[model samples]
Target: MTRSANEYLKRILLSPVYDVAVNSDLQKLDKLSASLGNDIWLKREDQQPVKSFKLRGAYNKICQLSDAQLAKGLVASSAGNHAQGVAYSAKKKGVKATIVMPATAPDIKVEAVRNFGGEFVDVVLHGTSFEQAKEEALRLSKEFGYTMVAPFDDEDVIVGQGTIARELLEQNPDLDTLFIAVGGGGLISGISVFLKQLKPDLKIIAVESDESACLQAAMLAGKPVPLEHVGIFADGVAVKIIGEEPFRLCQQYVDEVITVNTDEICAAIKDIFDDTRVIAEPAGALSIAGIRKYLRTNPMQGKKFGGILCGANINFHTLRYVSERCELGEQKEAVIAVKIPERKGAFRAFCELLGGRAITEFNYRYSTDREAHIFVGIKLREGRQELAQLTESLGSNGYNSFDLSENEMAKLHVRYMVGGRPPSLLNEKLFSFEFPEYPGALMKFLDTLGERWNITLFHYRNHGAAEGLVLAGFDIQDTERGEFDQHLAKLGYIYQEQTDNPAYKFFLSDVNGVFEK
Candidate 1:
């Protein structure tokens, strides 16, 4: 174990990170501080030229390479941020750079790398994941004479990341705790070594996504271990294994390791946006989410805490999922599945029980003669306790309800699959529509359609974009085709008929002749 805090301190001091990286601001988070009753500060590394802290380490490592190595150029593999970092650094150093990225990487990130590196970077999309891309990069490095740039494992990279801690301690010397997001563990390992040696009393906490928690796993086993499966939602920090060097540093200097779920990450994104008016990638928001959870469990009041806002290279399409889950993540919404009698007044009675809190989502289909299962989402004002009370109230009123708030299957799949084909429906036509996303746009759509035709099935989800996607089924006979066409023209929305879509046929079609409505 060649883990020397003093040696790391010297390396950090001499690190050439500043040549290509910004000394990011340490901004005070007033709203978060007021809510938690503590002094909260954010290390805004997301404001870097690459829109991530990765440039510091990448540039530092590249600058340290021998003249021969620089002349040969460099090769690296990254999911997104590190690729951008390497590309930008290589462009600045006037070296040829080849970045191999996962085919699954977002288009925005790939395009940014090309634009940032200009004539210096060659981006190759080869594999479906980072690990595979990394393997290809290594193969190419051997095949050619290009030097390989490790994303987070190398000593120079770790030292470069440590520079953040130097800035943090200088900016806010009174911090009691620091929260850092951990993937391959470079950032936390670097920060922990520097801060622990400098301020022995300061707490260093490592935050990781529960789906890809290699750091927590390594800490438990006392060695780096490969995770069998990793979630890709927070693709920036979705490492399957911790680096050996980073693991050793973390084992020695990191105070604690904690994991947060997808919802918590989404909620943290919302929190950051509220304060900084900036949306963070899920991985970037991991530290803030961990901080919130720590405050909940530890209840430290009036203490100084700092969280690193690591990166902000989020894909635009992912905002819809983040927005939809944020409310549930904050415990401000509860999704429940209820079984009500198929009679007409059961839905009305269930609404009465709800008492007008707010309906975020409601999906139902008459699938059976005796009972109908409805998936409903209600806006929560109080918290989880309100959800519990609502569940009890439903039972007392003779409605059978199952809380789906914590059910991952329900949230991701079943909610959208709420309406399957029923046995009695006649002349059902499925159509897809896109409307300008705005307040009351859905209501306007429904109002314009009116009660002229019975709605058999409907699905609409807001993806936090310019337009909203909707799938609808209506009972329209061939005789009423002309009238339906006129209604669509009057609505003036982009529409497509998906009645024959294979996905609908396989999963939603009442193939057993069970249609009864």
Candidate 2:
């Protein structure tokens, strides 16, 4: 008998399937490539009517089956893409396809399978995850006399997926790299084999979301290893363990594997829409995100590379989060925690410091003492650093501050609560400054705000040292210039006019153009 490994390689090499699963026309992505600062192309597997590259493997595998096997029908399990592929392929081959999908699978996916004439068995959604659904599917396939079509582990499936590499090379003979999203590693395995045979110099990079980096983790362990936990954020590539065969093929033919965080993948999704006007599910854009990250760190410069936008089966609601998080990842946004003493004039004084920034969220936390924590979400200026220096200026006058950007739970919940007693006295001053970010920016500001005024409210967090937003309030007996502008000017910090309008009420009924209470 032919070695399964060799047979798989030959079968994929001879797949009578589409001459190529990924073509050059489909490979080029103007939007995806431009972000890389290189000539990058996208193998548009998402363009498939089924909305994924899964069809390549599904059809190729089924076509190679004997007539008797086809007559016996096929059984498969999938949450989305693979299910669509098997259903579509079975309909094309005039075979019955029974798909066992968890009740939790997206309704859209179930509909698509039904549209392709695949019978759906809605199983008990008792399992904690999709992999459990597959286990049930496997047991049912055996009981029902149905041949199982493994999504990415089977030799036939790998060969079919390899067809993508064959076509990609044919389209761009000069292409130096190919980025494929890894789940069970079938796509990478097939492409690695074909690409290495045709072009030994081609760099095959596998992109996997960190949550489901089964193949990458396996390679690291030198064997298939299951994840104790997996994040379903990118469902398509969320495999617990990479198939043993695919792993061996990967160890032999794959060049490199990389993982991307969910945030990074979300950023890439927005980037793709900005370029291609197309929305890709997180899993579909995994390779594109990886390639973008690679070129960002490696500088492809004038080289040509290819990324596969493999699927578009995203749930519509996820796009909202993907867009919002992408903006945050780009540093165009931030949520801040502001500390202010419970004082009358302090709130108004701090309001004056917000010049160019737009407020997005404002919440107050209640406290028994005179001081309280204020959570505020604000748009950051293009080039701002940590908030400490700004807080230092306020601190000198009596304000102490800390950043909540690193506190995930605070950003999620605490940011919305605002509680504190009303101030009875009014003695505070407010001012905004642009200061040089240095080793002692905060301490210097503290010295400058002087020891006379007690700080009431303060908000500043450094992202880097270039520049930062400073919102602070000080309890000063008088509104005289004193060391206010002097210290700022000495440090090359500018006193910026923030709020001068008559419509907004001042926290401190101060007595000046920019301050007094």
Estimate the TM-score for candidate 1: 0.82
What are the clashing pairs of model 1? 320-463, 422-514, 422-515, 423-514, 423-515, 423-516, 424-515, 424-516, 424-517
User: What is the C-alpha lDDT profile of model 1 across 460-482, one tens digit per residue?
Assistant: 87654334567788889899999
Error of 2 at 511 (Å): 37
Candidate 1 lDDT for residue 77: 98
Local accuracy of candidate 2 as per-residue lDDT tens digits, 1-517: 3235456657766786673233424546665555556887877777776888888898898887888887777888887888888888877767887777765566677688888754432223323346666888788778878788889988788888887776777677898888889988878888887778768888888899987889888988999999865665687887889998889888988889898876678877887777777889888888878876786568648788778888898877666658655655444466555557777776666655655567676776544357655566667665136344455655676654454444432432234323432255445455555444445666766676566556765556543322343655565555555765565466545454333421011122232112111
* Alpha carbon deviation, residue 274, candidate 1 (Å): 0.6
| C-alpha positional error of residue 26 in candidate 2 after TM-score superposition, expressed in Å | 3.2
**TM-score, per-candidate, Cα-based:** 0.82, 0.72
For each candidate in the order shown, give its overall lDDT on alpha carbons.
Answer: 0.85, 0.68
Q: Highest TM-score, which number? A: 1
